[model samples]
Target chain A: MKRWLLALVLCLSPVFAQHPADSAFSHIYVSIEGGEQYPFGDLIDAVENSFYGGVGFRYAYLENIDGFILFDYSYFKPVPEGVKIYGAHQFSGKLGLDFKWKAIAPLAIGAGFVCDWVRGDYDEDKLDEISFSNDLGGTLTDNETEFGWFARLNLPLIRKETYKVGFNALWKELWTLPKRSETLSVGVYVERRIW
Target chain B: MKSFGKIVKSLVAFCSLASVGAFAAVDAEMEGMEVDQRDDGTFLVGSPTFFYDRILGAGGLHSESEMWSPEKLRQRMLLDRMSILPSWDVMEPSVWIKSGNELGDMIYRDFITAENRPTNRTPILEGGFRTPSFKGFWVTGRAFQDDHFTTSNFSYRKSFVDDEFAIFGENYPMFSTMYAGFGYSANSIDASFLAGEEYIWIFSESSRWIPIHYKPRLEARIDASNIEATVAYEDAEYQDKRKKEKGARKELNGSVYYRCGEACRRGMLQLSAGLAFRAVDDSGMVYTHLEEDRAFLPFVNLRFEPFNNLAMEAMFAVNERDWLVQDSLEFRPPVPRYTGVVVGVKNISGTRLNPLADGEEYFDGDTISLKADGQMNLVQGYTAFSDTMGNVGMGGRVSFWAEHGAETFDVDRYVEDDQMVYRHGDVERINSWIRGVTGELWISAWYREMFSFKALGGFERVDGNSSRFEVTPVEFFTSFTADWLLRKSFRISQSLRYRSDAQWNLRSVDPLVVKGDWYWDATFEQQFPAHGLYLTGTLLHIIGSETIETPNAAENRLRFICTVKKTF
Candidate 1:
């Protein structure tokens, strides 16, 4: 592990030369994306796959890197048959830096922190306090938020003078209670350069 | 080894990153909980308002917060102890929002578990903004409350107060403060005035959590030329619902100091003087009483450096009732070419650690004396050395200290009420001399702009009648810290530390031994320099056992906090 880390650092040192700090936001882009997320590990037992849609703001962070901020929304249905709630509404925000290395041309790999806020959509008139404690999705009636990290691979399929079409595959983990939750998402995006 | 070298460079960056001192976030939040992330000594946070913070080699059994000094004039006085957390010190010109929670809240685990379910976890919330200066004037407001440690003693403390004694939540947090004010700054003058209400729980020597509610605490500060002055007024209310008792205290406290300027600092002798005073008017059962309801402490500081390598420093404070003196002498012998070495000895002799604190505490009907009759004297000798090799630096220090008449409690007995125990005691002292020897070693390595690393370890051997002491300090501690800043934008500051068991001797019948444990804390931050923006997330107490560190206090659970801020 030490040798591998040393090699990676040595390999990246020459390119690690920082760009002009003032050059940030010099080149900006806006994008819209739609994705389908699949629950993994223990999360599979808790929730089913869901589709999400989000928007992103990207800017030049370095000579070979782009910084991006994303905000997305999704609806998840509980897997448990006896769960009281029909579905949960989740809003996620992500911030990351996409590395555009020459060795991985046209494929930018990025990683950053992600936060999710969830609330269960249910009918209050039919709810009972005793049953809520014994039900699977009772806690979702209140606002629940968790933060974690994410990694994504961005593949630009078609490049144009002012617009680009791309595919994104991302993996995220939420630092949830009882255990951690993981998901894999695949999405397509359309980006338009702003500057 | 090479990876660790990048750690120290980032430590330096972490200090600059916060624009404050080295007290940055390893805790979920940084300002008031600096001791949470420290591994250099025994920093036990019994509560936000009460803690036993003493760095190794500091000498004496007295915790650092108990010793009053000129610099701590702005710190809140909780009984005799001083603290800066849940501080109203204000922040730099920035707008920020922060929120966090204890990590054990069951998101889905609540469904399958029927018996012995985990207690509900609490959270913290803070949001404020300080606008940019307009014509040398600015406005600021902040509301922050931490509810992490309120769950363990929730029912026990709820019996003491009516309703939910906090600003926003029913959790009855240790502190909740909301303040708004404005300030003006110029070349020669700077001043500010602020008014707000605050709720705080202070742990007393009698093993009870005393809650104080300040309706409108007003403070004003002005620094002009070489003189700095500050004053505050607090209308505080206290109540005990179970006992059906109520009290109020209207108090005024402030300080004014004329500091030594460049001209005085350039000379062989430097002198500064200050006066700190507090006066109160009490009505009803106030639970505590100041001697004559007033205290005036006039203090002076002197620094004499007659020779190139020798220096002497001392601080003296006295009133009609008591006197305190702290002095130190140091000699820096020019040894090896690029190495620095310091040999010093210091002494502290005082009738009362804090003469301004209330002299008596009223527990039920018992009048517990807060001040001992005799004085305490402590003396210590130490030597420290540091040397740099290329990008690495190493230093070590050894010290031996002894104290006589160390402050302790002679517990008369203990009374249990509703699963809560309270002690009856009067402040006393150990007449016999208690001795301690401490040794510490550290090595630091750094890389330019990218990373910094430091590893330090220390141990102290204290030989004394342990049962009589108030707190037997942690015998040993070790810490490895690292900080990495990628391209001056992304930061990862991490620390892994271990501290030996520290025993509290008199808080209970058989000491409450805080067992040995290791703790890990990390903070990851992303900065947008051109936009003056930062996004930060910190995780604290990742690997330590969630045990109650103090009597009647809550467990120290793992916490995660995220903050977003934009500066002008």
Candidate 2:
């Protein structure tokens, strides 16, 4: 009778243990965010401060590290008084890793590499003037892809088992073919656990 | 040797394998944790004796309550949305210099002459400074000089909110901005004639936001000018006896716009409508004929994005002109009165009047008459598509333009009896109409970091009926451009353009036809990032057919241009 009881208990242990640990590991989440982004370096000379929105997916593989992928889109106008750029668009994608401190509750630091693309169309005649006079060359209208890297910090205000509300600040630099563009952004997000 | 495709595939496969390995570790850890916690707290909570003993039962119980309730989550989300508002201010200053030269026979139009084709060399110089201050205040000035003309202009603008007067909120002022400007221009037509004009203008505009989605703006401008001319004779001293005309023009314009979504975002729709009215008066000249004129302009524009990667835009406009002076002596050359012929002048009694006599009214067969009323209508549309990555795009545009007008002219007839006669009653009224359609396709790619290319092809067909003349239309046009970045601060660019043949009206029985030409240009640019200075050199029209036989076709010449700019 004792041997039968031990076998039964061992068999049922795996089933009961799956519920608590599943919440900590192998977790999937989706988030939506909106914020403002400011240009720096050469990018500031070409464009003004802009607003952005993004959607992201995160997978927590370890208790202290989470992997995430995101897509962001932003809009702004060209800088300087007479620049003709209007409704300029910037798009970027990122794959990154986040480091968390369980003792600090919901605070995490992240670093990542990104693929970025930017494009804007203005009056060709006016753009010619800007290009020739300002030395922007072919960057204004060409949909060029750039490789970049970024660092970010996040703090969750309300951390629940199923959902989290947080804000993040990030700084990024994209190495254009012949120039460098940089941006600093702060955003608020709402994340819901999916799996 | 490995292809780029193979390399990319290999990298992706490697990443997938690494991800699988990482996930496998998590799975193994999960399995271990499950085994360790197999018999955790189950037996004590399920025992019958523990349930009977209240103290043990209470000690064994474990509660599973959520860390945050739904109500608390909703409140935090609301607080996040309300606290996120960002604003910034920027100030930038820049200086630039542009210089170029032209060598050709250029066609110039005057108030009286239909065409003046002159073979000459022209050098141009332009420079400017701009300073944009905080709070939307700015000042700018520029000077331009060429072989035939010199001009300078200065402008200042100030924008502020009147907190004492609010339209929607205390921060939203009812009054918006004020601006003032002055300009001067002098044109020298060889050693025989010169013309000068000076103008001063002031403008003010106000905007108000209604509710949350609509904005309306009203603007007004008042301009005053003085125009005069002089003549120099070979034997006689130069004289400035021509009449001095003072003119004033007033314009009022307004616009309203509506937006249906967040600013500067996709999936948004925007619509705008605008209208303008202008009035002019310049009737103080004696030898020159002047008239009062007015115009009405209206337009509508719409933009919408029905899909994430596609956009469509359209615009329509109507313009009208009334009582415009077609030929003014103030802007034309004075006809010589020493030809031993007397021509009748309308609105003036004397047949032979010296133009060099100051404050004296003289007709000299120069008639100032009203031009025909003109109207125009234009419509345009565009559609564009871009990939999700935004690395490549294609777009197309179509436009239709139409104009209709008529003009009346008084001509001088010379009889075989050595007498020149002017007849006001023999008025010639000419009706004119022109309509055209243009279509264009453009594509660009920046697939690589070091090189990129852009191309545009256009086709246009224009047809017109003029009581006086006609010409053939442009049928096709194309341009291709490429850029190469050799380094971080240096670049080289090249472009080629081709245009189809076009006809020119020579005021003769048959028009002059010119064949199509191809033009090529190249440019090199360098930047000093440490000092915020940029320098560029360009060679234009380096290779092309140098000669074409149009009535006033300019001889093609290789031109060089250099520019220097500084930014702060």
**DockQ numbers for every candidate?**
0.28, 0.01
Point to the candidate with the largest DockQ: 1
TM-score of chain A for the candidates in order shown: 0.88, 0.76
- Report the C-alpha lDDT of model 2 over B289-370, residue by residue, as the tens digit: 2223444434444555564433444443444322111110111123333211111111111111111111111233434232
lDDT of 1 by residue, B35-131 (tens): 8777688887776777788898888887889988888888889889978876878789999999887775655444434456566677888999988
How far out, in Å, is residue B300 in model 1?
0.8
- The C-alpha lDDT values of all candidates are 0.82, 0.38
DockQ of 1: 0.28
Off by over 4 Å in 2: A1-195, B1-92, B103-120, B132-139, B148-269, B275-277, B286-449, B458-471, B506-510, B545-557
Best by TM-score: 1
Model 2, C-alpha of B483: deviation from truth (Å):
1.6
TM-scores for the candidates: 0.89, 0.35
